[model samples]
Target: MVQQRSVTYVNNTTPLSITTKELDLENCVNDNQVAIKIHSAALNPVDSVISHAANKWLVGSSLKTVGMDYAGVLVKRGKNVDPKFQIGDKVNGFISHAFGDQGSYSDYLIIDPSKQSAIGHMNNFDYLDDDVKARFSDFDINASYPLVFGTAYDGLFSNGQLLNSRSRILVNGASTAVSQCLIQIAKKHLNVETVVGICNSKSFEYNKKAGFDHLIAYDESNCLEKVQSIIKDKFNGQKFDLIFDSVGTSEFFPIIDTILKPRAEGSLYTTVAGSNKLKYTGGLKEYVSVLPLWNYAASWNPRRHYNYTYTMVWPKPAIMELASLMVSKKQFIPPLDSVYPFEEFQTAMDKLNTNQAKGKIILEINKDY
Candidate 1:
């Protein structure tokens, strides 16, 4: 039996606490599954978030691999595996499931597309078999898109309700990878008229390259006041169609009534930021002060005027295909921040945990690739 080195952890630990191990590559999977030799993989913020949760609500042993996005060549397949996915086919995407043992940090991975691919969101939604298959000569770059871009696409459409080309949007944490994708998709695909992005002062030009029409420096004082001023001046007191919080801050949410259109007006305030705004500047203080999770039941109130929801990425075939098509047409660009060798994963995680990376941080699993 062959053996491979993989990153492993017991959870509830800091990113630097993660360790490595060797596993015998024996009968990795069966039935509608394929084994892949990963060439590249991408790191994400949620990687540490889930790890710190220590398998809460997820069943896993003390040991599990770590990673989500990966790009590789198929090496083996189960008997019932789809004929369309043959050995040697190059593919890349992400695994988003309730389990952690099946991570992509290793040189080898076994995935059951029907369940772990996040396609159709664990088959909860409809997805195509080939939706996750997109290859590029640069595996590091390919490894970056599936998670962030997919999240952006889902955040925009899954709950976006009835947005169209004329829609206007406000994106917090505009420099975030997912936010950048959101700006681009809303502008180029949906043809949104005006898209405003909030980032640090230094990233104005950088965020603009991601298709943000207007950029604001959140680092400045009275940021929300400026946001309100824009609403009053730019649209003549018109509310924004969408207020997306990518940095996890609820700072814009409480004042959303002034910044967003009402439910009656078909407007929404959606955040990917979870409970805390996770400003990162305040560290634990920020995490503890994260916003209260929005409840759907709140919408039951007859007097309710605002539509608000929190969403995470759910893999959908249509969205994945659209992204893939856009990539092929060069209509979508996934920003790349830096690459780390497999051995330097801890350093990579350090950067990611800072929430300071301008784009995706990739791990070149197969350095030769």
Candidate 2:
């Protein structure tokens, strides 16, 4: 048994312990998977939850691994794989749910090329090799879309029910990784007349600079009431067309209901820590709908079948292509708060636990490709 150093839970209650572990490469579905020389990995709350609550909801089968989003270089490709990706190509993408095959924290990480959502598309062909350049660019085109774009991209267009020229939107947690992109895309792509951001008063300056029409700090006395007071007439004399919530705390919901017109469509997208909870009232439970944003991203068209309305959230190829263009154009900046050296991974996790960081935390892997 070959051992690889990895961070794993000693038990559900304990903090992750770093230890030498067997490389269960054989557990992967196929042999053609390529190993990524991980240069960096982003720390998400999901990782911590899985470490502690491994049994409650996140069942660890053969599929338990640390890290989800990674930026790295292709070190080696397995057999039967196309020769498009040679060694040393810069890449970034998400690791799938199958943990044994998708772990990205190890020195060498493996991924199926066919399954990657975002990868760097490099053009390193000689001028003479036009056909080769085109072919390589086409085949190895790891579309360089950032992970931060995922929640915003999916939430806005899919769940938020946005079209190119829809009504203005108010994003509650505008400084979040997801909310930043939401503002960018709404400002750039959509003809939004207004983009109000409700967040900490300290973040008011930043959100104002980022193009928010109004920046209200929720902690301020009667902040929600203030919003209502200011926008009451515009909202309908009593309503708004849409309200996007990245903060799902119970407190935010009444404000959401207040802002929305009685029959108007509104969506609330939450990227905050922890799972979503549905609230119900007496005898009205049947009509209430509580949804996860991912569900809309996967299945654009909600369908009613066999006693339930099911919508599958998916990464559409077209939306990803749009994200690629947005990246190359630099229309939006992804929120990368801080990068931690591999040895200081625990420290990075600590910072994220504070929830005070403005953006995403990244862990840089030590090895050079």
Candidate 3:
């Protein structure tokens, strides 16, 4: 039997254990599935959220693997696997934890082509532009790109409908990995002229260089007042065309009407973080709280003509492909706050819990790979 190391979550009280188990090739790698030797895995907040509170909702069993984003090499291809992908191909993407079967923090992963979200091939360094190539040069860092980028892409282009070059955008939690991607997309792809980012003073320089035209430091004593002031002063009193909230807090809801653009067609306010309240609740309470909060946000100020929506990255291959193309062309740069060896998984999780990581945190799974 082939055995591999995996981080398994049993319960909140018990420490996450690294267990050795036989690889269930037959069950995990089904028709149209591609088996991969995971090289590195990236950490996301949802990993800890689900592990601590929502575990049973996603994984019926008490013991389940934890992780979402991964970059790896294809080792086996099911008979019906797509021709475009072959054994030995290096790929990066995220898996859905909602199903609860497997996760990216493992020696092996099996992805069903028909069901998986955003898996794509990485181009060789020779083909990549020199400036952006160094980032992807490390498989550990490359592993961090897909999930946050996909979430940002879907939030901005799909849910927010930020289609016009004239659109003025504001990204809350501007220092987050997803926000960094959103800032880049707004500037490079959408070609928007005015891009505002909200973060602490420490990240002001980072976000500014990432193409944010204006910065609002939320740590200031009068943060909301400052946000309003920026809109009035820099934007000529114009409301933002779209507000992408990656922080998921309700802090902005009360003042959204003041800063958001009012359009008869409805200005869009999309959030990757659904509701701040839901994050603290668990089990039936969490499930029950989600809808009402969504409703409250959606109808909060209808008279202002702005619509509120929430989004999660649902793994679209096309989005991953588009991101790959942009990265190859030096348009999208992957952001990384830190990388830890697989043995230091707990340390990596600790950094993610701080909510202070400048970018994504990744675990180098197979250092040799």
Cα TM-score per model: 0.87, 0.72, 0.89
Q: What's each prediction's clash count?
A: 3, 7, 1
- lDDT-wise, the better of 2 and 3 is 3
Better of 1 and 2 by TM-score: 1
Estimate every model's Cα lDDT from 0 to 1. 0.73, 0.56, 0.77
State the displacement of the C-alpha of residue 26, model 3, in Å, after optimal TM-score superposition: 7.9
Runs in model 2 with CA error above 4 Å? 1-4, 21-32, 56-63, 79-84, 98-101, 116-145, 233-239, 255-257, 261-320, 367-369
What lDDT score is found at residue 27 in candidate 3?
55
lDDT of 3 by residue, 148-252 (tens): 888888887675374578788888888989999888877888888788888889988898878888888887888888889987887789888888888866788
lDDT (tens digit, per residue) of candidate 2 on 1-369: 345655555334445545565665445325567766666677755455445445433454443557666666776667755577676676666554522434556555776666664444332223324553343232122221244566566656654464445465667677776677778888876767777788898998878777787888877888778678657655445444456666544354445556654333444333332124322111122112334444334334444111111222243344456655665665655555666667787898788766667767777664443
The best-first sequence of candidates by TM-score reads 3, 1, 2
lDDT of 1 by residue, 108-206 (tens): 888886665543111111221233223223677667778888888877888747778778899888999998788878877778889988999999889
User: On a 0 to 100 scale, what is the lDDT of residue 264 in model 1?
Assistant: 88
TM-score of 1: 0.87
Model 2 Cα RMSD, 1 decimal: 8.8
- By summed lDDT, which 10 consecutive residues of candidate 2 come out lowest? 304-313
